[model samples]
Target: MGKMLTVTTMFLIQMIITFETSGLYAMAPILSNNFGINHSSIILVNIGFALAGICAPFFGVASEKYGKKKFIIIGVSTFLIGSIITSYANGATLFLVGRSIIGLGYYNLSGLLLAYLGDIVAYSNRGKIYGIIRAASGIGILLSPLTSTYLISNFSLKVYYLIIAFITAIILLLSFFIPKVEKRSSYKISTVDIILIFRNRDGRLFLFLNFSMGTFLVLYFSYIAVHLEAFFNLSALNIGKVLTYSAFGTLSGIFIAGILSDRIGKLKLTKIYYLILIASIFLINIVNIHFIWIITFIMSLSFDGGWTIIQTISSEIIPEERGVFMSLVFFVVSLSLILFYIIGPVVYSYGGFLYTTVLSGFFIIISYILFLKFAKNNTEKFN
Candidate 1:
């Protein structure tokens, strides 16, 4: 019962964070019109989480020594405050500030959530719970579009954001119920200690895989909506509906990856996902909207499923220093987001969506090669 509560709490909390994260994208068209900003500027707003990730390694080290639950409290509190600020923002500047703070708070919880799971759940059975918890995470994005449409259409953009605040507030209150966990590591550490994550052989492979595959995080997302609007003339409601349908892919991906990862082998299944993601990216073409939707669905499923497996293996790579390692992994993930946001728009602007997909496909190809050659076995012998 106790473990169930923790999993449920973490599951719900992850869903909320992804809600806030994906909501900005779902609500982008409205935000652009209301604020008089372009797609690029709207997307740039998400850089906030990447910015906050800079501090994550330090927090990771602290959590290992001090406690995860308290930092979790602090993180959720920040998210709540940011959500309220977003709900009440009067203009583009204030709105950006509010949303930026939400990103800053996002990684504090996101990076730690996995590590927190590592603390209570042993490796042998971790996949079962990871599937449930992580699959639940996809639900946030699945509904963000529909919910954003409802709130903005019926109430106002302010209400749309405030609903997020209200939900977050409830989550903040429930956060207190998280059972206390004793410190996981006794060693003193600093931000520099994260370098250890790179020292091991598996750690090096993880970093490579993270970078190659990490770009997938924002690769298509940076301009998918803009492309849809420009090319297909889809309205916000239609786009939201489309993305909602696509998010089901994430649900399926998480479930299958979670259940099968333990039995089949994490790295092996990850390879298949990587291939699916690559093929899906290659199959992306602007000629047909239905084709695009199918590709997007495939991408969503493979990305979430494969990445979950990668993160699952990551927790075991440096068990004693998982906090530091996860922070480092997230830090790389932040870099990946930064890379796409910075490079994606430029490629899309000059080259169009085709060029952007090609670039992303090339990145994954490199990642796949590195994983196959270097990580010959599931677990690299790390000393």
Candidate 2:
């Protein structure tokens, strides 16, 4: 396939996956209603996505050993099947079982899309394209909450999932346009080599940053809908509107992060991004703002946008094994979510949501300091 066609194909497919992941938040109430459960318990559906994340490393390795094109096709197909099952599920356990299948597909699907980008783009332009592709994720982010809210409020949850499932079908058709990429048989690395990836010093930092950022982002999205409904007394429609506005901020953050990463050094820019993320979270937690909607919008932009920069840096950090590295990053992120999100509501139940938010930020601060101490730039050339 031609470069432009390939890029366009990848962008659209990634957006579908992104929508499925982020759109779940807007559908939380609907999922609860369908399953006859409460919102907090229904939040575990987000945990299913994270569980998929933990499996990314295995997918990363498989993509490298097999071919990216093949994995993308399989992953997308599996996601469609999973979504269909989940949509028809009559109970919470069956709903999660369906979600788990979709989740497993997500890891490979997301990892390969990124690794494919890493293969096509040169080092200098990688960050920019990564940002642009990431911005497409926001398109799905913008659509999911609003679309789900409208469908659920006006129609039904079953209809909403069916619509998204159809969209996923379109995404799968577009997957054909992506160029095929085969793993380097001679360059194949063992599980031991994967372990040695952590010994790279900077690799460890990259992994930790990936983990920390994942914790904060997932926690925010997982519960933001519930918070809006309970604390601010916003309806599903208004929540979608609020999320759409915040997505604009996130969109801007993504583009600017890419531009800045190219101009500034990746490391310096990432450090600054983390600081911005920390400050934004602090404001949300510490301030007693009555206009909670405005705060949520601003902070979502800062936090999500800043993390895009971190992701760009990560895509750069372990360039040789982009698929594997990204997989590990996704895995760590999923691990954190399963541990945090599964128990987070309990923490919120007793300690308050503010406590969990503050704790996530503190973890970011700690991880940032460690990354600053150990992470280093690559001297190896990529053209």
Candidate 3:
């Protein structure tokens, strides 16, 4: 019962954090208006978060040496503080600062939670368990936009932030309920340990694949809200409705992929998802406005599904070092966000959504080829 409570509490914490993160993207239009910034400038909020994520690998190592629960508590508390600041911010600089703080907490909690789960769950069932947990987190993504849109339209953007902060505070209390796990005996986690991760062929492949895949996924979500508003002339509520449909697809994909990953193996499933992802991106580019929701749904499914598989593969690669490995995975993801934020606006300005989508598809194709050439053999070794 205690174990179940611990798992449930952790899942809820993840769900709330996911909600907060997705809400920022969902409310991008309103935020731009509220702060008098352009869409391109607003993206810096996400970049700030990514910049803070540079600490994830180090935090991962710290979690192992010190303890996971302490870091989890610290993370949630930091996120709460950030949420409070963001809620009250009247200027762009303050908002970005708050977001950066949230980023620090976000990566810490997300990375350590996976490592903690890896400690408790058996290797055989880890994939399915990750899927379940990710699906739970996906609920936040599923509903955040819809809820944010409704709240922002009816009330104010500040209300959304306050609500998030309040809920996060509640979760902080629940986090204390988390059961303690046995810590590693060695308190020494040197730079060499992290460097050694890259020495493995699988590690290199996973980093490259995660970065490439993340480039597509992050760019799509970060700019899609703006695209719909600018290109299709959709209202904020309407855009949120569209994203809601995509969120459903994300949830379905994570759940299904989780089950399939355990059965078909992560590598094989990833390849299939990659093809679907390419098709979905291409279809979205050409599809009429009315049919875009369907295509976006497919795109979200493929992108997020493939991401779940790859994350599972990453965790399994160095099971003993799951914290550091997952943190590095997130680090690469953050790096991709940083790169895309710099270039995404330029791409959108020059070529618009079609060209941007094509560029993302190009990245995915390269990632698929890399997977086939390097990761296939090493990935199969574990599966």
Candidate 4:
């Protein structure tokens, strides 16, 4: 019962974190109006979050040395505070400060949580567990836009932040009840440990793959809402409704991939997922406004599917260093966001959405090739 409570509490944390992350995208336009900022400035929220995540590797190492619970507590508390600050921010500087804090807290909490799971769960069942956890997290992404839209439409956007802050506080309290796990090792992280990660072929490939996927997904998500409003003239509520399809797709993909990968193999499923991902992005360029939801759904499904598989693979590669490995993966992902926010708008302005979409797909194509060449036969061994 205690174990179950821990998992349930973590699941709720995942949901709230995911919701807060996705909610920023949904609130972009409203934020722009509220703070009187431009597109670039609005994207700073994402950039700020990514910048903070640069500390993930360090946080991961610290968690291994100190323990996961302390970091989880710090993460939850920091996120709650950040959300409160963001909810009441009246200027761009304050908003960015709040976002940066949220980013820092998010990376610490999430990285440690994955490490915690790696310590407790067996490798054989990791795929299915990841699927379940991600599926739960997907609910947040699924509901974020709709909930944000409703809140913004009926009440005010600030209400969304307050609600997340309140729930996160509750989750923090529940976190104290998580049963402690034995630390895997007492060895402190060093330069050798960091270097060894890249020395492994699988680790290097996975990091690069994560970087590519992060770039592709961020580019798509960072612009999709704005694109809908600009190209299709959709209202905020309608945009939220359309975005909901992506969430549905994400949920379906992660749940199905989770189960199937355990049977058919995570690598094999990833190959198919990449193909679908590529096709979906290309289709988005040509699809009519009415069909946007379907394309976006396919995109979300394929993206989430591939993401889950890779994460499972990362956990298996260096089971002993699972925390650091996951942290590195996310570190690259965060870097991608920083890079994209800086460059994505320029690409969109110069070449339009078609070019930007194609560019995003192109990165995935490279990732697919890398996966086939290196990870095709890489399968997890059960301990």
The model with the greatest lDDT is: 3
Clashes of 1: 0
RMSDs, each prediction?
2.3, 2.6, 1.6, 1.7
Rank by TM-score, highest first.
4, 3, 1, 2
Off by over 4 Å in 3: 378-380
Runs in model 2 with CA error above 4 Å? 186-188, 286-290, 374-383
True-vs-predicted CA distance for residue 323, candidate 2, Å: 1.9
Model 1 per-residue lDDT tens digits across residues 1-383: 77777888888889999877776666777777777877755666666656666777777877777799888888888888888888887678777688677866787887788888888887877877778778777898798877887688678877877888888888787778888788855658743565655778878777667766667667676666666777789988888887786688888789889888877777788889988988888777744876767777888899889888877877778887787888778777778887777777677677777787788788888888877765575453310
Per-residue lDDT over 1-383 for candidate 4, one digit per residue giving the tens place of the 0 to 100 score? 98789788888888898898887677777777777866544676567888988999998887777778877888899999999998887777888888889999888877677778878887777787778778877899999998988897798757878998999989999988997776545758788879988899888988999999888867788778877877888898888988898899999899888889977877788888999999998899889988898999999999998898888777877877888888888898889889987888788777767777888888999889988876545544421
Model 3, C-alpha of 292: deviation from truth (Å): 0.4
**Over all chains combined, what TM-score does candidate 2 have?**
0.92
Tens-place lDDT digits, model 2, residues 1-383: 48887788778777877887788877776677777767766777566766777778878887888888888888988889888887786677767888888888787777678788888787678877888788888787878788877887788657867876898898788777678876765557687888899898777877887777767765676777777777767878887877787777777677677777667666666667667777777676555436555666677666666677667667777787888898888888788878887777776677666776887888888987875665443422211
Model 1 TM-score is 0.94
Q: What is the C-alpha local distance difference test score of candidate 2?
A: 0.75
Instruction: State how far residue 244 of model 2 sits from its true place (Å).
Output: 1.8
* Candidate 3 per-residue C-alpha lDDT over 256-303 given as tens digits, one digit per residue, 9 for 90 to 100: 888888788777888889899989888887788989899989888888
Let me know the TM-score candidate 3 reaches against the reference structure.
Answer: 0.96
The order by descending lDDT is 3, 4, 1, 2
Candidate 3 lDDT (Cα, whole model)? 0.84
Regions more than 4 Å wrong, model 1:
184-186, 379-383
Candidate 1, run of 10 with poorest lDDT: 374-383
TM-score of each: 0.94, 0.92, 0.96, 0.96
